[model samples]
Target: MLDARAHPSCISVAVSRAVGEAYAARNAAAQINCSETCFVLAFVPGDLDGRRVAAALEEALEGVPVFGCSSAGQITPHGYETDALLLLAFPKAHFRCSSILFEPLKPLSTTAIATAAQRHEKTFSHTAGWHRLGLIFADGLSKQEDVLISTLETVLDDLPLFGGSAGDALRFEDTYVLHQGRCYGNAATLLLLETDLPFRGFGFDHFLPGGTPIVITGADPDERKVFEINGAPAAQEYARLVGCAVADLSPQIFAENPLLIEYKDRHYVRAISDAGEDDALSFLAAIDDGLIMTLGQGQEIIRTLQSGLDIHDEQGRRPDFILGFDCVLRKLEIEQKQLGRAVSEVLCSAHVVGFNTYGEQHCGVHMNQTLVGVAFFGPDQRTLY
Candidate 1:
């Protein structure tokens, strides 16, 4: 049963018990041809010990390679999950993996990120320009993703980067990074592959913004913090637009009505994660001065998420694995209608097995709401069409 596919050799899924690790393991096993078992996890919240967790994982994998991090939330074929641990094991022969950690993002510089990315790429690029994709996981709170993305792009142009931030179950404190049976803080990791493979990172949302544009009048690029927009604090202007009290604003509500910013003509929505002091808004992505941003449009209870599956069938491509970067707000929207179970069913039907991210990265840019995801089709399995 040696699947002669030059796709992802294997995928390692690691989540917390709060995320229902047992269920996650079942789904992951069914996704790709995983080896024996998964690198299991039990997110013990405040008492987390990376050393203990890593040690257990290394022993369990029995020398098979494993890589992942603690998540703010996890996803399965069943959609968004919380409070559990999940880890999937895929072998190295099929997937050449390299793990790296990059921190000290405060005085962020593209030069530094470029250097880091080059070094990280070299880890698995043992054979240059042969990698199929780059899986990146960085500090969610780093607040300098723009520099990181730019640096990676410069080094790995068109080398598609897909992944999400290491989240801490909405606690927003003490996020962790996992590598070689050890969890570190304020770090980043890259699991690389040196396979020439065909892949596409696709996305579709109910995105149809109101088309009203507002300018970012004041801000600090270095901090990635937006203070004022159109003559008032960014948060205040947003509150007025959404007709909600500034005090009532939060990441949950802001995600419901994300603001869309125009970049290079096309539009991209920026998910506001935190509302800081004096009406400042902490955006998940970059927002430049004089940029025109419109209110993003999408229903809380979107119904067409499964429409993509048809493409999978019609295009003659069967997925080897699905890496989903779902916004936490989208999960809330699903929960509001008690559609959690239904959403989960659709994702399960899609054979998805990954984690819920505070935010997602696609082609290196950070975004929310939209499912900026990539599906791998083994060179052999994808011939179904």
Candidate 2:
């Protein structure tokens, strides 16, 4: 049970297990006080009908703009959940937003996207005392995230952006983003938000680069598919590097032993999503030939996760709530290590409300096996609506 009174500074959060029906959305919507709500963000279970959920929310919310996508799983006030429909209502008293939807993400035109984003930013009325940030939700199966995020960052310039690729419960099929009352596939949405509360955007993963470097000998960057690694079949090479047989390759194995690529001064994981035909490998993020990467070594996941979420303001006050975009791979890793309950405890204490994703977007990069989020802190001595 989520008690809104427990966190006065936070926005309304409602969760419902009665899915695939209108009454369930109505029951959930009834829990949120929508008088001041500007928009409602929803995280629907991948097993449900997106169109049905979208229609229900639209009818129940009575015209409050709704936006979101199907997720691999949700993190509610109660922590990790798989079958619930989660909603977060952002009140107009504290937040304002404008959203843009891009369909047919394939054959994406960076030029067009950049132009539209720049124009959208300029046209949106900037609130006098509010800080600005961006959130994006794209079809997880869409291989366009790398290009999409990079273009947005380049055009938006200083505005911080964080998001996740929508997932279908690890089914790796048919994912959709919902806007208004419609569900769209091969699509994405960007929400430019202005908020009065102080906030911080961050991302982290629990892995370190260690071991001999493996070079990408052949790859299809556009498709994010690797054909060869170190002159051997991609999956075969990865299995050898991780000390596993080709037949033993699995999501858990990929999560446990990810490939790390060096960028600037830090390393980022380039997770393999699946082993494909002819020992080929499909990745979650962008990949190309001649890219040198190393096997990632595990760390104390719980410790790193706690440290990552334990953010404090100048006054040493914890955030009221965190909007998290955790990768599904991370969840897989935690479950594999039998740390689900422990990890859920950490998230519940941190007041995390969001969903697990196929990939995460932070700053200007698309990454895998990481958690990206924004933490919001209320103004001192002021009550949030």
Candidate 3:
């Protein structure tokens, strides 16, 4: 999809994965004269090389900044896809972006992160009608997202933040975040956005508590590993509650039935991503020993998505495009229920561009099984326009 507006900074999206046709991806980005292009790549074991792909894109786009990372699945105008590449080009006229990279992420002190955030904040001129947002891309395997987001939030104060965890498909092995032409592991990159457009940041999950509370009796808070729930083995107990055996529990099962934790009066999903040999359950978000979690049921996804997007549409002005970070677990649920077509229709109609993530970050908290995004309205909607 391409925006044909007369504005200087229009956007366009392209996707491809033809065998032996590697250059097609980079060429796609060059065709659209964007100042910066973000690329989401498919996770194929040894077949994909980050350095080579980055070089090709750099050579093709010349001086344009290239960013993004590997994804569990690519989200495009056509629908959800695997083994494909997707790119989004941001025009230079309306959008200005600056980024910071935090490496060896786990040991970075909150003070260091906060300092970096404060420095980024100082670069922007806070005009009355201008909107600014922070876009983050982190390693899904780092396990440092919780603290990093918290510290950054403290420094950002009121500047809205939204983003996703980079994934290597479902491999759960290694994930990389792209900056310029290099890939960084155990790291995170933040993009500071400045635009003169009406925009809103929002997040949603199509699930509600089922009223059955499961108490975490024992857990490894540091690793998000639950050893016991209600005095029984975590995996065994969860399977029993879901009407399935421990061995039968899979991503599909976990997607249909998830756990939700209420924080500050808002509910967030604590999705189970894997089961250990000792019958322990590992969650996507941080899990503690004393927290009480409720089993959640999936709602009508299409309606929920539409209603959530509608909340951002004000004064009859709809979003021109949305930069979304959707959870992969949600994709599994939609596919398992044969709702791919319907879900794709909604995503396309809403002009969503992004990828399925390992997790989502919003308002300083790392969450699971949710869709977080920033919707940008057309320039004409702004007061200055």
Task: Please provide, for model 3 over 7-115, each residue's C-alpha lDDT reduced to its tens digit, 9 standing for 90 to 100.
Answer: 2234666665644324754656555664444332223212356556666666766657777877888777666776666777776656777778888787667888898
List model 2 lDDT by residue over 15-66, tens digit each.
Answer: 8998565867887899888778999999988778888888988888988999
A best-first ranking of the candidates according to their TM-score comes to 2, 3, 1
lDDT winner between 2 and 3, please give it: 2
Worst 10 residues of 1 by lDDT: 38-47
Off by over 4 Å in 3: 1-9, 20-24, 34-47, 124-129, 382-385
TM-scores of the candidates in the order shown? 0.81, 0.97, 0.91
What's the CA error at residue 187 for candidate 3, in Å? 0.7
Winning model by TM-score: 2
Q: Candidate 3 — what's its lDDT?
A: 0.77
lDDT string, candidate 1, 117-159, tens digits: 7766655435543346777766777766666766776688847
Give the range where candidate 3 is weakest over 10 consecutive residues by summed lDDT: 38-47
> lDDT at 87 for candidate 3?
70
Q: Poorest 10 consecutive residues of model 2 by lDDT? A: 1-10
Which predicted model would earn the best lDDT?
2
